[model samples]
Target: MRQATLDAMDEVKRSLDGIEAARARLASRPSSLGGRGLDGVFTRYLDHGSKQLTWLRGTLGSATALAGVASEVGDSGMELGILQMTGPRLQAAMFGTLLLATWVDFLQLADALLRDCPTCGSEKLFADLHRVQSRMTPTLADLASGDSERIEAAATAMPVLMGELTHEFDTIRREARSAMEVGGKVMVAAQVMELLALISTLNMSLPRPPPAASTTLGMGLVMSSGGVIAGSRLVVSAEWVEMMRRLVQAGVISLPAVSAAVRIHGGQVMMAQANQDLPEGVREALGDSPEVRGMKVTGKAGAGMAEAPRHHVMPKEHREWFERRGFKGDMDIDQFCVRLEQSHHEAIHGGANWKLGRTWPREWNQMIMQLLGKSGRETGRALTRNEILNIVAENMKLYDIPMKFTKGRRR
Candidate 1:
């Protein structure tokens, strides 16, 4: 009877494993590859972890074969018992992979929201690419030439570039914390954060040495798209804006980093989004909005807020699909984003320049004051960091980019 009990427990464990794997896949839906663009790319990466779990399940199947062989040897399935422990380890591996992929994907998706029109707050996605290119081109020279004078000149100018880089990393870190890791493991957050700091540390390396693998903590975040930040309140946060404005005088605080951080801060702007359940049929009339499903009628359909004709995006697959239909070579996503920023003129609210290219230094905390001063004179409202995030989310809604909730939210 005891032996039978153990066997039953093993079967239950196997069944439970299967359920967990399935749940993860359903929640993550991790691939938008069929037509969703980057959103799909990220989802597919998450799905890959699910596929790994399937392999683990298959590995466990071999346990039965070992059990039969042990039975033949009169060993009471001793080999199978040995194989049992492997399942739990594989389970851990699957969980780790899922967590990693989810965080990375969350960062990417959030950035998409920021870079896109509407969410960029009157800016384009690649607004800062030129700045990066300028720094990278010469810095690449520093990395190659090793001349002290040229390197020193590069170093003096680095804070501007470093600011952007720092802001980008901080944004990735901050958004990764809120959206991706919410209700998830704190240790996981710590690890990812350490990885980010490691990247930041990499920025100051040229004067002494190129960033070593150890310093990066193995993240290899590099010049890849992973370095981009999502739009966020941090960009326009009163604290940061005031700080950045003072940077011109201070001479060094990382304007680029500040810009990147602002973008990251903007990514926090997520709302329940309008849906069919919301007042007015605007959601439905928008033709399957990406931001909402449908709308609900609040009053007689002539309410005060309703008069503005509140429209929301449902599922933008069809619209975006048509937009990208004739694309051939790799899309010039950077220039496309620049145009997006220019789309908004005097109507630019909240006093942010809204040009991705126009950014402040990160370490220069005084820019916040300048920004607020400018806001007081222009927009009549000085925003806190959180307000900036809300506006960013609003902008994302306008752009029609796909924003997904974390995997746990699927249920």
Candidate 2:
């Protein structure tokens, strides 16, 4: 996980470099419209991308820290068995698992942001803008001539083109900002989790009744040694002991509640990981068998026929949409698909006997398209891979589609 976080950080830094280069190229372009043309829009676009990349880098750094801490805790033997133990150690283990879960969430979100928003770090947008500007150069040059008719025509045409470009820029910026906003919220939530963990650890580490009893013993000695002065000190010591006792009592009472909540949350996180349609890190971590090579293509596993037909989680019909959102290569989309039993696959797509209008308004594929369309309309961008898989998982559950591979696996 730490390595993954570091890799994401490196990717974000590379994107920052690309944004910087794009900005430099935009800067080199002569501004014939005096900062009100494509130059201005492209500059803002690159600047926004740069800012998002910097923010992502910082978030990944925090994730790296959490990942490191979780790793250390895991190495110290805080596995599932730790939950059965008592005392501060169990509290510590619970917190560690919570942090680990939080780190996993951050990693998934960061990976999704990188995949879904290529413009967040790439120079492709700037390159496209430059190409558009190059195409308009001849017309722009005509504006320099003293012909009133040509100047008027150019003036009339340029703003329309500029307006269209500005609209496109605004749309992309909004989408990028939306994606970054989600990341920011996740980071804030992780910080809150850390704060809670710290409080829980401190509560558990309090000296308990021993320190307060010791203070009382000291008060007795002081009172016996001196008269009025000793009495005054004794009163102060009593108050201190009382406060300590109250704090310890509060810790004793509250610790169990906090532990229970964290345990419940941890369970939810594990469940979510299990429900993912794609077998990525989650499957490996849970000790599932390795994916069969060429299983997706031949639909066969070794010498035996595969257990089920392969289902494309993202739907192969909309391959172009996924391709546009960074699943570009030929086999890239295939990686997202999973194999399911023939019955499960049919059920997901609406079983053979199921009719369109009489049964339901949409099948699983149509439902996915609706989800994608709704998300795109809301965010002004395509859904990220994580987001798409999440929708797939949720719909599978809604339809009671049993996962063939994960049916008997321990979550």
Candidate 3:
């Protein structure tokens, strides 16, 4: 591995250690006067923090594995592929480290509030806080394996989880007012709102699988299985693709052999399809022709059917602003669209009240426009493709939008 990658890994590890120490110190704080109810809250907070640290450690392990593979690969092209694969894992580890540190600070704030005003730490409040902590625990314990599917699932669950936390905190704040003096109540409510902001940040920062990778994997499964298996059944995630490339580079597998096996498997699937009987719903869903099924699996509309609505990640309304900022050429703003399920599309654009400016899509577009305008004003030139992507990624992180950008002519 390159020294820079090694250095990054070391820094991440050190940061993790620092966070652990901070959490330990918080955990070791003297018990609150409010008895076991308050103590239980503190313990649960520490336990949840520990779980997050474990997940971060697992992410670092994955980055290390990719780095080892990158070091062994002689081809520059392969090296670049490894770098791309490893970059996000490291970024996620670092991001998680920062998030955990902030979480600890929030916990400390809560601890202090309870210590000064034990009456504020009502049994009901403690119960609500505990519920939020339980909800925040990692869904998968074996995240150290760096399983992309599990990680994506966990990330997908964040928005709902954080939203719940926000609601609970609001309730906690409202209830706290009745149990404390006016000054103490104001402090508690302010702290709770700050925590709510942190929850929003957490929702946006969690890593999600890119749409292109999922689409490619879905299509690959359909083609490989000769339409016998549903495309949605076996997605070849980006992590799996990277693992395969690493195996090939290490000489444990050959491309020709893999190709041959896929072809053979496809033939077998075709034979099975001929003799097997499918359920009525399955048969209806698959239709009578393999070709038509393949088209539908890949999100393509047949002659008489319409595809799902296409939502432009880079809003079409502000096309000219993006065009002026180097969003044309290979990275055309027009090509950045994703076909979303109808309800999802509606939700993004503000559902039935889309005309209002408060919806996610509207807010996201406004943020992007401001970014572009700022860049243009500062540099007096177009932003590079990578620069534009960085801006988009940051905005997505800020707004809790899933990071799904597709670049190509719409299907």
Model number with the top TM-score: 3
Which digits, one per residue and each the tens of the lDDT, describe model 3 over residues 210-260? 444433321233323223333334322333333433433432222222222
Over 1-411, each residue of candidate 1 has an lDDT whose tens digit, in order, gives: 223323523643554465555446445444333323224334443344345445434433443433333243322222232223222322222222222233333334333333221212212223332333343444434422322223333333333344344455455446545543454555655665554444332222222213353232211111112322122111133332333334312222222222222322232111112221421211222223433332222232322322232112111222233134321111111101111122232122212443432243311112333443465467665444233323323444454322221011011
- Models 1 onward score TM values of 0.21, 0.25, 0.39
- lDDT per residue, candidate 2, 1-411, as tens digits? 233333433443454454445445544545442223224444553343334344334443443443343343322222111111111222222222222222222222222333444334435445544554444444434443322224333332332333333333334334555554566654544444344334331122122223235333222112222221222322123332232223223221112222122213222111111112321222222222333111111112531435656665566777788777655432245534445667666666665654442254556777877887897789886666545545555665676653221111111
Measured with C-alpha atoms, the lDDT of residue 29 in candidate 2 is 49
Off by over 4 Å in 2: 1-307, 351-360, 397-411
* Highest lDDT scorer: 3
Q: Which residue pairs collide, candidate 3?
A: none
Please list all clashing residue pairs in model 2, or write none if there are none. Answer: none
TM-score winner between 1 and 2, please give it: 2
| Model 3 per-residue lDDT at 122 | 49
RMSD of each: 31.8, 27.4, 24.5
Candidate 3's TM-score reads: 0.39
Candidate 1 Cα deviation (angstroms), residue 307: 81
